[model samples]
Target: MNAQYKSCIEAVYRCIEACNVCYHACLKEEHMSNMSKCIELDRECAEICTLALHSMQRSSTFAIQILSLCAEICDACGTECKSHNHQHCQDCAQACFRCAEECRKLIS
Candidate 1:
């Protein structure tokens, strides 16, 4: 794969990993109620990121479309995660933002 594609894929992978980790960590938090939004967004972001990764891997005609949605979800997830104080949430926010930026590059 080309450098650009490789880099974007790596970003997506990192976002997916971060989202998953954050989701589980949030679930285990003492006050899970407060992390409801973060948990929901993490699940959605991870699912969309997986789709984006697969679409890019196959060079699908809808890859850009899928990535557009992925970017949107990543932005939302990042925003939600950024509001939290947990280390996992902060890490997830960074990854989600990075993934959104990478996805935007291809779409633009």
Candidate 2:
């Protein structure tokens, strides 16, 4: 793959890993009862990131569309994560924002 494509794939993979970590971390929080929305978004974002990674890695014909949706999800996830005060959530939000930017680049 070209360097640019490789970089995008790497970004997607990193986002996937970050989302997975954040999801598990959120699940373990004692205040889980109040974090239902975050938990749900985390899981959904993780799944979308994984799918986006795979689609980009394979250079699927629909990769652009997938990445677009991933970008949207990442944006939403980042916004949601940033609303929390937890360190993990903050980190995840940053990662998600970065991922969204990377995905947007791919779109253009």
Please count the clashing residue pairs in each candidate, in the order shown: 0, 0
Q: Per-residue alpha-carbon lDDT of model 2 for 56-105, expressed as tens digits? A: 67778898899899999999999999998988888889888999999999
Instruction: Estimate the TM-score for candidate 1.
Output: 0.97
- Per-residue lDDT of candidate 1, residues 25-57 (tens digit): 999999999999999999999999999999888
61 Cα displacement, candidate 2 (Å) = 0.6
Error of 2 at 84 (Å): 0.8
Q: In model 2, which runs have C-alpha deviations exceeding 4 angstroms?
A: none
| Worst lDDT 10-window in candidate 1 | 1-10
Model 2: how far residue 101 lies from native, Å: 0.3
For all predicted structures, in order, the TM-scores are: 0.97, 0.92
* Clash count in backbone of candidate 1: 0
- For candidate 1, give the lDDT of residue 99: 99
Model 1, 79: alpha-carbon shift in Å?
0.1
- Per-residue error for 92 in candidate 2, Å, reads 0.5
